[model samples]
Target: MPNFKLVAPYCGVRKYDKRFFVYYLETEENIRREYIFNTDEDVSNFSHALENLTAFMNNVPVCKKEAYHQEFLDLLLREVDHKLNIRTDPSKPSAVALAIEA
Candidate 1:
């Protein structure tokens, strides 16, 4: 399995107006690939997990890395969950987008 780093993230509707959350990951070789979730539930779930991970990471800081690490994480989380999520959701109709819409 190739190791890839998360590069960019975007969410929106796909073909058929299906909700989508897509991440562009790049391998060390500079190969880029799309990791897409077409269902709102999957997108919501993943964002919740990512949000939680970002929060957990903030609690532990390393020497000389504190200044920029949290900023990077905040940017990453905000970008990935651009629409924002009000609560955990497991059904369709994006929890993230829905919250923003409301």
Candidate 2:
């Protein structure tokens, strides 16, 4: 395989007993593709490439980034809290954001 660099990666996360993360990115040549981290090594390798994995929230069309990202952060906090005890919040965000960080 040829070497490729993925820039401005877009990520989505889903829970199926185990969380599944899918990353979408455009190559240096502008080729778009999606990748799934299927193993510990895959995640580890991806993390190594990204010193800081940041969220691309409210990224409409999964490319054009829009909206206040902090809202996503706040929602993430609430969801994490909910996970701690399974408590429901009236103002909870959507059940799924499919947040993938690469």
Candidate 3:
């Protein structure tokens, strides 16, 4: 439905740990989405990456890969924060906030 492109990339390495960063744009919405790749395999496989990503968005389990799973959850939270721009208390009735929290 939309064409997307990467606009920026950042990497942080600490000892044996590494993070791959991506900032991208979608023409259909004029939105810049950020992504962090937690594992090297995530950077290499287009198919598994897509599947892993979809599963993450749907809030499905990512098998044994907790790091990658958490990355997606964080991205979704950032998106909610970008949209809401509010300090959401845990007790509040924020469907948007609650969905993200979920």
Q: Taking the tens digit of each residue's C-alpha lDDT, what string does model 1 give over 6-84? A: 2222222121132323322212222212334446765666556545644555565544233443355456546453342
lDDT of each: 0.37, 0.31, 0.33
TM-score of 1: 0.30
lDDT of 2: 0.31
Clashing pairs in 2: 11-100, 12-98, 13-98, 13-99
Candidate 3: C-alpha RMSD after superposition: 14.4
Backbone clash pairs for candidate 1 read: none
Which candidate model has the greater lDDT, 1 or 3?
1
Ranking by TM-score: 1, 2, 3
lDDT for model 3, please.
0.33
lDDT accuracy of residue 56 in candidate 1: 56
lDDT by residue (tens digit), candidate 2, 2-99: 12223233323222322222223222222222233345554454444332324333234543442233244344335231222122233433222212
